[model samples]
Target: MTGTATLCTVTAPLTLFAAELGMDEGRIGLLSGIMPFFQALGILSLPVVLRFGSRSVATTALTMRYVFLGLFLIVPFFAARPDAVFGVLMAAMLGFAVCRSLAEAAISPWSQEFMPRSVRGRITGRMALAYVPVALGVSWAIQAWLDGRTGLDRFVPVFAVGIVIGIAGALMLLGLRGGRAADSNAPRRRSLTEPLRDRNFVIYLFASALQSIVFVSISLFLILFFRDRLGMSSGALVLLVALIPVGAAAGNVTAGWFVDRYGTRAIRTALQAGQIGLLLALPLLEPDVPAAGALVPLAFFLFGFLFQAGIAVGTVYMLNVIPPASKEEYTALHYSMDGLAGGLATFAAGFLLAWIGAGEVSVLGVDLGKYEVLFLVAAGLTVISALAYSRLHEEGALSVRDFVGHFTTGNPMKALWGINRYASRTSEDRRRDLAFQFGGVGSLLAKEELIAALRDPSFDVRHEAIRALGHISAHPAVLNALETVLEYDGLVELRYAALGSLGRLKATSCAPRIAQFMEDPNPLLRARAARSLGEIGDLSSLPRIRTMLHDDPDLDCRLAATSALGKLKDRASMPGLVDLYLEQASDRTNRVAEPRSKVVLLAITKIFRCEEEFSHQWRREEVQSGLAMPQILLQLAGRVRTGAPGASAKLRELTSDYNAEDTAATLAALAELLPALHQSRHRDSDLAVDVLNEVRTAAEPHPALLVAMAAILNRIFAA
Candidate 1:
């Protein structure tokens, strides 16, 4: 249906059609202004939308929009005067606007509510991929058809086809599952003033109003600027127009992924800044110059891309910030706001263009035309909008600087590079490009290319290839490749990566090969091998690991060995682990010794399942004074007990450095738990109560004690 709509009403044809009907710039602007005003009126139909559901409202409205569009296309044939033709077109446009506005108002809330939050951006992005090609083809075809025909003869068949196609599109909507009534309650009736009251929304409202005022001329005058100012032929103009949809499609697809990954605020703000940059470049584009063909299309493509991308991301952001109950109201209010601003802006632009009367004016030695003035104003308004957007907060949002850095360095560029190798001077460079480009978790689509790269002679190529394959480890080809690389690859780093990947994937079949690397000369490789063995849960390698734990001179190797012993539940290694801990525990003078001591103690706790006893051991040793062991123990205890209920809240209280006396008091109380739990097979209720009392007595109780205290009480209550 959207394809059909594109066929009937690509903006170029409508603007051209108005010109063919002898409409002046002011009349065209007035015609363009009619739709937004009707759209604003359409918002008042909220009660109607609520009475019937969104799907129903959208279907009905979309059907009516096409109906009027079909009528508008045909009505011109019967009109004798250009005024008669303009009047009928205006009425058709008004009808179309009413339908379009209702559809727009309901669709946002309906779609947002229907889709799960986790996959909405992904699904929307994928849908955009489909939307772009269809739109580009349809728009290209429509323009090509219009450019081929003389006069207004092109309208009849084009709009007729559109009506048929649009009806089919409307039918497809019947299958869509819109509202999940159970998940959300129906919205209550509220005054229209509610949305206007929000500070953020109000700020955004002003920004949007400014932008609407700025862009009112663009939709009305851009085609004229190209045809009249640039002297572009209709065929060439169609091609230029096609670039807009092409850029828009690409933008929507990419915007979905970024909006989902980075959060909405970053995407919205960056795209706004992007538009500012594009606007700044507009004056530099002298399309009338003999060599300006590429520049012309490039300008349209980038502006279309950034503008559409910003719209897509901004829509998602609005959906997120608005609550479920008020989504309909907020969306309607936004449309109305745009309509009011657009109408006024359109009239003002028309008046300004009329006053300027098609001649160039010099302002500060630069040639200023009405189009240039409008674009510059739009750019200025966009700056304000971007500033207003900066105040928005969303979880997981990147700052503008971080967003730019990530885009320049991340997978978006990788995808772009895959399409065109950006200045690769060597085969090795190309291979490296393919490696990072296709190395992500979802890069299985590039499996064959990645597999081929694995055979490349470049070590960097092979290393990155191995790492990329590891990311998609669940793929059978990738898994087999990693296993082969680990066993037969000549590069040690590649084999080491494969070993770690296999460990992360828990490839128990690779255990024997990993065990061989346990004695590798490279200490990092040996440590990783031991860690993999533990992760694979292969107890057969326990003795070899214990030997490493006892004899490995390398700190990392010994630490990895102790970690393996702990993971394997090897209680026999507990004495060695405890010895390792105690040796480092009293070395208060060595900063490095304290962390390793904690790791050793943690290993003991992991093996014995006696975290309380271990926590106390470190805490009591600190009572000797001027040692950091107590703080380290508190951190370790906090980590070890993270699974307990309210554990996070407890850690916050305990770890805060605001009150040193309270922190020490809470730690002192918590230190009593290990002995109490170890002494009785069953928990001693009196001892639990005493510990709780001690914690409660502190001026500000530490959260760590609250957690330990809860564990003691639960054990006591269970007994």
Candidate 2:
């Protein structure tokens, strides 16, 4: 359709062909006006779409459009006279227009049904991008072919190629998953005129129609401004025309990102205002003058860009405003009105040209003419449209300042930096309050101030200060402050924040102190202590967490302990968790068992990746034979929280071969793995056989291997 539409535009072979046929400007206007006239009747075509469903109607229309395009190619070959050729051309165009109108009516509603609202702007922008290169290639190909050739003969091969490409597009549509079932038997919920009863929708309808007039005016006359007013060469005109699609393509890319993230109301306002500005500038510049020729392509580019951006955002905005149940009816009405306005606008441009003439006129000492008057009038209508658009509301829209910030920077990280700086300077809070805000922003510059804020007279300030410090992660100063807060701060919230921050910072040295908090009188404090211990990843803290999970009277504290054990990923907690589950389940009246069961399920899921157990097992076995096994070996060693092999003389000899860190890690891994291996033997898991085989082979008198073997056996069977 795009390739074929290009051929029929006012700038194209149709314009020259009309001239060759000696058709007057009024007749040429009527020719360019054909599509929208039928498209304005697009609402009347809705029954065809609803009857067969949008998918079927759209596909059939696209197919028949190509059939008409084939006739367009062959018509010129048969008709020798200008009258016959003109008649056939008009007939072909009418057929194409009617088919396209049905498709246009179907596709918008079809797109709305399937496309997610969150990313609609992005997808629309990408669709515009896809159109750009094709439009450019077709424009270049047609222009280059017609450079030296005259008459209708040049279009034959172009139309033939268009038919082929259009067929490919049609075939591609056949594969689309027409999302919803065609509910032909569904009862009508409301009359078609019901949407017009919506006052806001009526205002939107007027705004859309007004904008459509200006858009059509620019598209119909921009080439004439370059050709008649500026005297640009055909070659220059061809190249300048390509700039329109390029700019529109670029607009889609940015417009989508802005619309999806920031909402569409601001984007629509800005683009409409931009269009008005560009239109107002049209009368002041003369491309024929020195240094002004450059503005012609730029004006055309901005024109296309603004048109596409406004339409893209407006379409998204319309979807947002319309009731979901009546989307198809409302959308069809909107397009019908838009098409009517565009058709009238095209005829009005021609009528003004014929009636008022293109001769120069002056107003307010400004050099203006008929084209200039047209531009000014269009700008006036766009102003009204812009005002009307502003009346509509959208949810989650960014403030104007933030929208401009996003527009200029185009990166969220940079936007956050800007926001942080603004919050730092503009906030009315005192230094301590400002420090708290900076902590939310994760501003490293506030580190010293946040550390100082920890000593503020107010406990609230100290609580926030600890939290902020945790977000920055612990430095030596932060760790010291947290320790001081835990030891001296009388407030429970402050103490909880301090423990949490220590765990988040992975302050390994603080683990013992955090462990002692598990015995605090407050069950909440005990829960926090258990969680922090797990976060610190200290194996020695396992005994405290295990005791809390099993013996704590408070269910919340026990649940937290269960979570901590899961984080530790030790098999040693399995027996205790199973016992806890059975104890809770035994009481039919216990409401707490459900949540506790979820916690146990979660722990087991985390330990084994229940969803991907086979995959993990495969990866682990693969890693055992590879160079990366040492890292896994160290992690396994770290899991050996509670039980250990008493140093068998054999195990001590093997321990002598490794560095302190590696030996400790291996011992932890073995302690954890040993209990898991014992359970695996009952289930007849392959891991049990592998572990037994490894032990038997290593039990040889080679002292180092024997020591390793004994470490495994002693950890497995020891109480």
The most accurate candidate by TM-score is 1
Stretches > 4 Å off in candidate 1: 74-80, 179-187, 209-216, 287-290, 407-719
Error of 1 at 515 (Å): 30
TM-scores of the models, in the order given: 0.58, 0.57
Quantify all predictions' global Cα lDDT against the true fold: 0.67, 0.67
Error of 2 at 154 (Å): 1.6
Q: Write the per-residue lDDT of candidate 1 for residues 47-132, one digit (tens) a residue.
A: 66676778888888877888877766665675568878887888877778878788767676788777777656666667666676
- Cα deviation of 676 in candidate 1 (Å)? 68
* Prediction 1 global C-alpha lDDT: 0.67
Q: Which residue runs of candidate 2 sit more than 4 Å off their true CA positions?
A: 1-11, 19-22, 74-86, 179-181, 233-236, 362-367, 399-719
